[model samples]
Target: MARIKPQALLQQSKKKKGPARISVSTIILFSLIVVLAVFFLHSTYRYWSQRSRIQIEDKESVFKGDDSFLDSKKSDLPGYAVLETAKGSITVELFKDSSPEVVDQFLDLCQRGHFNGMLFRHVIKHYVIQAGDSDKLGAAEDWTSKGKNYNRLYTSLKHEAFMLGTSKTKHDNGAFEIFITTAPIPDLNEKLTVFGKIVKGEDIVQEIEEVDTDEHYRPKSSIAIRRVTLKQSI
Candidate 1:
């Protein structure tokens, strides 16, 4: 090949095409996707952050004020329950002052041995474990399913982990069906009467929550409530 001059080579290279310019439509589409992704991520973060924050607040409300809160409500002994199950025993500090009706009903049932031999009919892992429906045991009638005129009680209590509350059935009945929150459930706040919280046997709750369950969330292995013993605070 003949020797090419430096100036000629430079001009020839300059004439060659550069990479094609991106279309405005493509740039717009990319920017829109980036914006949408950021928005979705931000929304997800906010949702989980709110959940976590509520859980933290609930813990403070439930566990931190165990003594002072009870003392303020009743100078006398506070009411509590010892739930003996096949798994283990779970001690619950009842909120008698705040949720008197529900707590009284629960105490009555416990004294009558109504909860004994009742199976935990529902279990949603990391959510809740429920029981107290006599109908599930083939009873004539579930007294819990009676009296649909349940006036919703709103309180500062929340569905914190190990917190005990009444389950709202499809029948919209009385506060007989009880449940324990395996995890913080902010959505359940003000919707149900929170009567108690687990003061001990947190591990037992975790164990029961992890049990194998059917499609209806019923425990396959049968976790029964052996007995419920009431206790008076000293």
Candidate 2:
């Protein structure tokens, strides 16, 4: 190889290009765009979350009514229902405003005498006492077919002791089977509709709870609802 000259090497070095450098303004602009995109996504998510929560709260407010606890005063109640059973009388305060559809259905059934003489088929000690089994009375087909399905009514009412609720399967626009809680049933709070609460028949409910039950949680002796009378609120 021939010897290269210093002046020629210097000229070749000067002709070679170096890596290009990015300006600080371009980098800052890119970073700002990324930050704005993340902030926009976060804000959108928060807006939708708050909107969904507000919708649920609004829906529940319709059934929240005035009472929130179990010990509601009789004078503040919307109506009253007296269940004359074989054991004793159970006076229940109807949540007419909170559960208008359910209360109306119950009142209609009482007026039509559909719950009269209905036997208490399901009973459990320190749990619940359930009655109005249309199947046992040979009227399941008639009862199930007469009403439109009400789906589920989400209410603020809880399944406190002496709370009267209808069967989970029969939430329709007609008569529904009834049950009274002997204890606080939290698992059934939103699952069942609470139409009324026992105001004057705690002892009677306790008496019914004490009745002997068989292996199927059914009362050994026949317990019947002789009549149900409705009274308007004063």
Candidate 3:
């Protein structure tokens, strides 16, 4: 009931209140750190998990020698083919669904060693690397004369000229020739069948693209296809 001085009232108020609490900024900063830590840990876990799964799947695919995992229904997962050239290996993802015949022919040729020792006849920078010339084979006479059974079979494959942006399977005059473009060539879209695309070793593709060429765009130094191996998930 006695009148309290201003100083005494202030002292009483201070004594009644608890210790100073954390600032709102401090609380917000702590929350942010916690969120960031959780996010980083989650991201790291996901990255390693995905990488491990991919390694396992790749190993299995190599051992199995089947690309059942890359069924045509699943456009996301396409069959892979590795072309081991003198320069380096270029792994391509075959669009089996988009151009089944072309893929089939390519695979068949690869299995039969058709592309082996073949030269990259034409390499236009930022355009395409053209190969698969049976004439380039050491035994050109055999190919020309149609003496070899495989050569005859290759010659017999239908060469349908499907319109650009119209049909997925057919193309102008692709036949045994395979053209790997450095960039999107909409002009050649209908003219050539794009069965596969280089997914890995694009640097090697670029290296090949930059190779010295003749007047006809043919590689001056032999850019041979040492071998073609298939790699796909099972």
Candidate 4:
């Protein structure tokens, strides 16, 4: 049975087809280099932690003291609204000292306007812009129903911004909401209940903290507050 030789059976069929064609071209070039290195590290982690989309300017922020904060909230405790927003207007003063059932249900719903147009959905830039829990308040082309009612699922207070000294920290929600902040969120000292600031507009709260959010950050457009006056005594 010894006879093999047609050029040694074509050199043993080129040594078994040269390592199975170099092991199938080295597994297709190592699976295309591991899918291009996981798409370049997921596009550089979404270009530096994504979170941009701004253009909320019409600006506003005026305050001239009579001890502002809606005049220290109707002279040390009462009710007030004056919401007015598109990118301007803010006045929220209330204090049953720290929050008597969220300032008496937010002064019985801004005395009634319940927050005029309603739509501060939530901004979060320097950190904070939220408006009353949308019952539809402003940016009014025609959308009414600021019923402003609440039992406040939760919140004894502590959501304030700015340290104890004020850089900016107005709040409301005793009935719905009214958030406002810029710099100075000293861990919402004494636990959120700033009552007021933004005497005038605050460059419309940094142009609604340079808005442009969606993936649950909520705030694409619609920051209406159009009306909520009540400079009452303060």
- Per-residue CA lDDT of model 4 for 1-234, tens digit only, reads 899979999988888774434577788899899988988888877764552311112122333443467656645544545567776665555454554555555566767777677776756555556666543322221111111231224333353332112212233543455656554433454334455545555676777778896754467777777777765545
State the local distance difference test value for candidate 3: 0.63
What is the TM-score of each predicted model, taking all chains together?
A: 0.55, 0.55, 0.50, 0.24
| Candidate 4 TM-score over all chains jointly | 0.24
Candidate 3 residue-wise lDDT, 1-234, digit = tens: 999999999999989998889999999999999999999999999999999999999899776655655543454433887878988988877877778866777777778887788787776665457665633322111221222222212321122111111123343564365666555443344355556666688888789889987656667888888988877642
lDDT of 4: 0.54
At residue 123, give the lDDT of candidate 4: 60
lDDT of every predicted structure (CA atoms): 0.74, 0.74, 0.63, 0.54
Q: What clash count does candidate 1 reach?
A: 0
What local lDDT score does residue 4 receive in model 1, on the 0 to 100 scale? Answer: 98
Candidate 3 lDDT score at position 64: 68
Off by over 4 Å in 4: 1-78, 82-93, 96-121, 124-128, 131-186, 190-193, 196-212, 215-218, 231-234
The segments of candidate 1 whose C-alpha lies over 4 angstroms from its true place after superposition are 1-78, 134-159, 168-175
Q: Rank the candidates by lDDT, best first.
A: 1, 2, 3, 4
Error of 4 at 201 (Å): 22
Error in Å for residue 41 of model 2: 58
Please write out the lDDT profile of model 1 over residues 68-135, one tens digit for every residue.
77677664544878999988999999987788877777877787888888888877776677886643
The lowest-lDDT stretch of 10 consecutive residues in candidate 2 is 138-147
Top lDDT model: 1
Q: Write the per-residue lDDT of candidate 2 for residues 10-88, one digit (tens) a residue.
A: 9998889687789999999999999999999999999999999999998787557544433354344339999998779
